[model samples]
Target: MGMFERTASVFDDAMVLDEEYQPDKIRERDEELEQYRQALQPIIDNRPLSNIFVYGKTGTGKTVATRYMIDHLQEDAEHYDDVALSITWVGCENLSSSYQVAVALVNELRSSDHQISTTGHSQQAVFNMLYTELDKIGGTVLIVLDEIDNIGSDDDILYGLPRARANGYIEDARPLVIGISNDFQFKENLSPKVRDTLCEAEILFPPYDATELNSILYPRAEKAFYDDVLADDVVPLCSAFAAQDTGSARQALRLLYLAGKRVADNGETNVTGDHVRGAKEELHQSKVIEGMQKLTTQGHAVLLTLASHTANSETPVRTRDLYDRYKTVTEKIDADTIVERRVRAHLSDLTMLGLVTVHERNEGLNAGRYHEYELSVQLDSVLEVLSEEQRFDDIVEIVKQQVHGMDRT
Candidate 1:
């Protein structure tokens, strides 16, 4: 390679191995892929495929593998004109309500040549319009609702599909549904009727074992980086750590990229084990910032206060003590001070977001239940994305001490 090309390669090499670089056709999951394929096999046979529920931890290839199967089914179903396949994939988070989902599905089904009103229609009318469209197409409809648990009215969407078939809305067309979620209790929360209809076929994607991750990542790494660029031990280390957490191929790829970037940033010629260690730290920081971004302003502020107080404190603070610190923080920003009840609510939000962890205790005698909360990720990591006033270099030292219990003067 020429000198300039080689120089560019350093950054490029890192990014090429990223999950963003992953192709839709390529995935490391074989068993899960086949199971999804079998689940949709009835749909291909022009029979009513049972509504499927796919459950797994996030980044475990559940979403990707499910999509992959749908793509293949779409391609393979071209032979039969009798088998008109219409698939609507919706991310439930973006469409939280049944009305919103109906609108989205209606808008998706309509052609640019044909104008369909997505607004000013009653929620029931929108669902009717959707059913009419499905009938107009006159074939089997497959709706894949990703993160279906995010839909505020999951039952409205889940139960609505099978019921559409039951009610003879689309008389000639059969509808099959696939619901995907990371929340384990999402199914339990569903109404009995919805659960019965949606769980006709259940597929659970377990975390990738180390062997599977290693096999899956090897080809991706080879395609992503220059030959012989990464040390012999780097890939295995990445695999081992990823398998331990969630066995997410996405996480493995991300870690690989982070490791390579760490090496390149340090002016190293090749990626090494130390690079992997740095990548783990960088990944931890990125996760914290992401968690902070998802919080409301009050939630973010609560976490920032926790970060600030924890920046110098020797131990995790009790919930009451943390609220005292939070009140002082609210005053500094000229924000209305929230009562302890509200502060408690925000703290729970923070814990759910994975920004902070709660330790519950039941003491002996009259001592009642209380919580001691601590940051899950380093304080410095969250400060970067939060308001600048909250950012501090001391946060880096604080995290180092908290995580490693190191004595840093």
Candidate 2:
């Protein structure tokens, strides 16, 4: 066997150990981490904890930092009998109603080794069960609602629970809430009463700088990869790429892992600039398409048509024009759908998902600009995925016609 083959047989260390990396081991967010911990320290000490709203763009380590601090708080809570720390973490997206939330709480409480309940019960009954459980435990119970914005339709859980503890309904347990959200507009849209209670302490985690990201990457990389597998430049590249949206440590870590895998797959012992570049290209392509796929089927239809039309066109297409093309395609498919306004809704969704970008230009300073949509992902990459479907030819033809018409117009 060759020397490299011998090394591969011997060296089996991986750069990323698991899907969830530990926060204590996370580098370069010392200030951010310390500030976050300080905000929740009162709760840990059996003092009243404020309901903190953490906001940032996606992957800024907001969730990770919050989880880490809370975990520490849980440990610290054990020593203080005055501070009864019970943590129930709920993701708002999974359950839509207050009833669902109550059920989720009871289920989580029951499943926990803390072992709050085991019997079958109604949602309301489960909530009562939870309340009793909280009362039994006493002291401060921290309810962490991750992606709290997704609890939209029945936000009564959010609106009511804090007040329940505040108004002496539980009588024993003082509940502290930490709500985490990616949506910038979440606070503005919340009911005035909900905002009054939920906004007591708001901590915003901004994106990580290159320096901070390097701090985070070094330890994680060192733990996950062989010594000297990554160059000094790789962390900076990952940080710079992720910084614009949200200085996402998660994204940087993901990119690093993918880059390492790319090198390993290509039969290299070490990761290099070429592997990093290739990972970026592959990640961008996959991210756009996968993100698009995650959208509603209607949203996918909107994208398929928009991308196809753009590919066939000589120039970028406007929203109104795309609506016209979409109408024709929907009719051919015999689907009953909403009109242009709803199409604009799907357009906005697509824009947010980064499948397409919207450019606005105003004729004069006073006159407001109008938006024109353009594909952010490669048109062919999108089409290649769509082409696997049965109606690919028909979809292609419609787009081609629209393009030719735009040229003639």
How do the residues 55-102 of candidate 2 rate in per-residue lDDT, one tens digit apiece? Answer: 877777777777788888788878877666777888767665667777
Q: Best by TM-score, which number?
A: 1
lDDT tens digits by residue: candidate 1, 1-409: 6555555444434555655454556455666677777888887676656889999988777777776788788898997776678788877777677777778777777887765665688877888888898888767888877887877445676667678878877787787878888888888888888888888888888888777778877877787788888899888889988988878877877888888877766777798877888898788767767767777767766876787667667348788888887787666665677789988988888887777888988786777888889988766567666654443234434444664553454
- Pairing residues by index, what is the TM-score of model 1? 0.76
| RMSD over all Cα atoms, model 2 | 6.2
What 10-residue stretch in candidate 1 is worst by lDDT? 391-400
Report per-prediction Cα RMSD to one decimal. Answer: 5.9, 6.2
- Which residue ranges in model 2 land beyond 4 Å of their true spot? 1-19, 43-45, 111-126, 166-168, 291-380, 388-409
True-vs-predicted CA distance for residue 225, candidate 1, Å: 0.9
